[model samples]
Target: MPDTRSGDRQMAPPRPRPKRSDAEDNRARIIDIARTAFAAAPDATLQSIAKAAGVGQGTMYRHFPSREALLLAVYRTDVEALVEVAPSLLDAHEPLDALRLWFGRLAAYGRIKHGASQAMEAATRADLKSQYYPPVVAALDQLLTACKDAGHLRPGADADEVLLLVSFLWRAESGPDWQERTDRMLGIVVDGLRTAPRA
Candidate 1:
């Protein structure tokens, strides 16, 4: 006679992992494609992005929901790429130089994002509020801390102020000469950051 023990229990089948929605997957794909196009050519159009992504216009729309949405994603992707390189910059270069390198990268990123700001600005005012500024700011803060620790920057220089200066330089200068200008401006900024005792 088979007697079931009180402790005996049939194991239930393992629960299946929930699948990601097609919309989520497609959204990610669209962002990847958009980033490729934006990187390859900053002025890439939506049609071009759709072609590069191997998705029809409707598919792109279904995923991104709007051009502004796609543009924000593209901007965020570019910023993310720059931010991801920060740790390596710190490791590979001196503390002060690492900050300079990151600032240079921000300038380049701004150049790539030249015309996209209008769309991004509009999106920023909307409910989306996903313009990727926080990551950029955080990256700047990391670089600033490194510089400060190395005594290469002024003790009280605010990260926001530095970012604003960089943004201003990026907006005013838009030519091949901009690189040299950026370097010079960076030098001035760095010098101002140097620890100076109160007069």
Candidate 2:
């Protein structure tokens, strides 16, 4: 009688550790290097970027399977940072001041993203926008709501409209001293938002 017992079943392997901090650090470094390399030239090679990042080509490939993957990673990282800052900003500063500071950071992020935009294909751009838009819009909406309730902004001041209005700054033409122009633009926006009449 060659009867097999229930113990004969093959057990699944145990899972790996929850977080790969080393992998995460490597991925972040790779993204940072890729952002610089791609910004200089969208067609920048993965070999050069990996070398610049002090990683093997295989490691870069593991973190980002494609050129588009690396580019999108950089953009998404920027968006997530901007979105994540909202709550902390609102907590640390006065409502109006928080909004101003958040938008100022957004202006800076926009400069980085503008350079990244050259690397994206149409489909990738659309996908990236879809993934990030709602969260960012919600963040801005929440900040606007807080500002209104705190008497920082007018009752009827609009978040989406404000998003559109300030988007021009995101696409602003880069020049030798574009940061000056960007700062001036943000100041004008903050002043306008502060002055809108309450209902």
Give the per-residue lDDT of model 2 (tens digit) for 1-199. 7546778866779988776788888999998888777666767777889999999989989988888778777888889998999999999998888898889888877777776666676317366677888889988988998998887777777877988889976588778888788878778777778756334
Clashing pairs in 2: none
**Error of model 2, residue 7, in angstroms:** 5.1
Compared with the true structure, all predictions reach lDDT values of 0.73, 0.81
- Stretches of candidate 2 exceeding 4 Å from the true structure: 1-13, 122-126, 196-199
Q: Give the alpha carbon lDDT tens digit for every residue of 1-199 in model 1.
A: 6657756756679999885687677777788777656545555778888887777889887667766678877776677888788889999999888887887887777765664555566655663324556666777788888888887777777777878777765475366687788788777777677786324
lDDT of 1: 0.73
TM-score of each: 0.66, 0.84
